[model samples]
Target: MTLRIALRPAPLLLRFILPRPSLLLHQLPTRRAGHGPGQRVIHYMGHQAGATQPPTPHKTIHFCSQCAGPVDLKFVSSEDRWRHICSACSHVHYLNPRNVVGCIVEHEDQVLLCRRGIQPQLGKWTVPAGYMELQESTAEGAARETLEEAGAAVEIVAPYVHFDIPGIGQAYLLFRARLAPPFTFAAQAPESLETRLFPLEDIPWDELAFSAVSLALRYYVEDRRSQSWRMHHGVIRKQAGAGPNDPGSFKLTDYMGLPLGAERIQTQA
Candidate 1:
């Protein structure tokens, strides 16, 4: 042939060959053992910004984050939305939602959970998760907390559930992960009294620390059975006549029906 020069592949094809930067940062596990590509993906359900109940003054609001002056909850704006505003300095102390990261670490057919030894829900069972720290991705925070609480290494699979708890101004990001080899169990975490793996049939549904934890576990079990998993994201609203700190009132009426064996944890005074 007179002209038989080979042409390079197009840039778009090269782009398709490259891995996603964000996906690489998650540190996905080598073995995608659980389900299909659908199950291994993160599907955004949706988002909602429900109004939070008026937060109680935890203590004497004697100072502000901005000026350290005396502050109190009042209508800082003409819109009638109450906020913590400084009376002395007129600085607004905008309260923000606290982000908590946790994971459902699966090994074979079992899931790892931790028993809390601290307040809020002391002695109750929960997936290993806690307040997210600064300068870390959600997956990193979840892995760190899982290691600290369950003493196990995990590779995050995908974001499993997102909870918008306006009642306490808490946003929970729960991920699905795989337990690394040599799965270790240690109650070394100060906040955790014990850590253990539970089969789907033996999960302590009645003793789960939070409603979202129970919901996530149930979803995990059901998804594995159907092999048609998808992300779950929704808002949980406080029940009428319930305070911001009251866990008994939080329910997912707008999401899937109430989780199995649901009961309110008696709020400690």
Candidate 2:
């Protein structure tokens, strides 16, 4: 009984003096409005990519940080600014013009097409496309638009095709895609009024949006054999009767009698 030695617990005072993990965590303060677990809560309020943030007290339009585009600031009834964002791209769009992205979708030997139910090319056949939104890769924008406009999913081929429409202040990024077999559109997607498929010969040349589309089509005909190409102003430059078919071949040629401009395409061109 005498062998027992008493050990006292650490005094409460000593425990109270020790540093706790909670205190360290408190050092990192979090903003009251976190965008999400991983996202930062940023208010578009009046800012856009390629534009400056926070209006100058009474300014209406702000610039965007990403593209320097003008962000339109609309005041509510009380003159309070309102936000309008593209649901697909999640960018704080300014009142500036929009950028369009498109895809030349393919399955088997045929092409995917859509007929316009609205004006500015209404009742015309064109590749799947629409406006590009904020915070989206060019290719992703192309694919997303293809699905929204046509209600189909596709696998994109490498190296996007780029085009700039002069005088219209429009830029285009087009992608080559392989349509997911048995493709169809999703419900409630309102960008397009109608969707259809067609053979290359059936493409509505008289109704397509721009010449670039025809250029792309001509390039694809040539691409099946080789990737080297030269396209200008929405026209396919093919040598006279260079492709599998001559009826649609180039219309011009160079000094060497080589088909020049969009007129002459090579065989398999």
Candidate 3:
């Protein structure tokens, strides 16, 4: 594996925009044939390169962090495409879905959500979530973020939902929580446009930036009633037209000529 890079953060929105903190730690594929769990993996470069298209993300591989040894590469076709396993220690350097953590901070039947005043779905609504900081627990990150974004104190209730996907390298973890009574809020200006507590019915489904928020809400509702719930991938659910060797270069955004939220965030310079 010639490309030797350290673990990096997830995309801007996944890290900075959501309300839940989800740190997706994955084991690397192993290099040896008979191996233990958590070993790292490496996918040697094949002769045929996909130059004219988006690089096949699945074909990507990783190497040993210390020894620079060859790691294993185990790529499941459907669900597990996101992780690159190390063949040796089964060590996993999770691909970027960039650990996001947020709380479902609430009071009675109402939920808390924040409005974005910044680019990348600016003016859209979502929870008070963000990327995990070094030396903090996921729950800590979530609780701390809730206070910062909403400017309201909160207590985490229970673990609610998790959105996992390998290809796009993003995951989400949300918790049920209650805002400390006497809820007080300020714009927190740039991070959010406004923060409010709303009854479940008042949530604006149409204007959410990432699809995971709605998916988490849906799962939360069904979970409450003992209804059969499916594990939703949130933003990175499988697509039907994808080929085994398909390069994920083109999509609907290309057709509509819409600007990606990241693009807008960059232009704000």
Winning candidate number (lDDT): 1
The lDDT of each candidate is 0.66, 0.50, 0.54
lDDT of 1 by residue, 1-269 (tens): 01122333322211111112122101221223222242333344433235454454454356887777888877533443567778878887676889999999888789998999897788899999999999886878888898888888777666678868776778889988788756676875578999988999999877888866866676677777766655655566656666433445555522321121211111111
Tell me the tens digit of each residue's lDDT in model 2 across 51-135.
5343533344366556565655443333343554333444655434356788887776677877765556656666887788888
Better of 1 and 2 by lDDT: 1
Ranking by lDDT: 1, 3, 2
lDDT of 3 at 118: 77
Query: Cα RMSD (Å) between model 2 and the true structure?
Result: 25.2
Q: Clash pairs of candidate 1? A: none
Name the regions of candidate 3 deviating beyond 4 angstroms.
1-96, 224-235, 238-269
Task: Encode model 3's per-residue lDDT on 103-150: one tens digit a residue.
Answer: 876676677789887776788888888888888767677777887788
- Model 1 stretches with alpha carbons more than 4 Å out: 1-60, 240-249, 253-269
Model 3 compared with the native: what TM-score? Answer: 0.52
Return the lDDT, model 3, position 83: 57
Please state every model's RMSD to the true fold in angstroms. 14.5, 25.2, 17.2
At residue 110, give the lDDT of candidate 1. 91
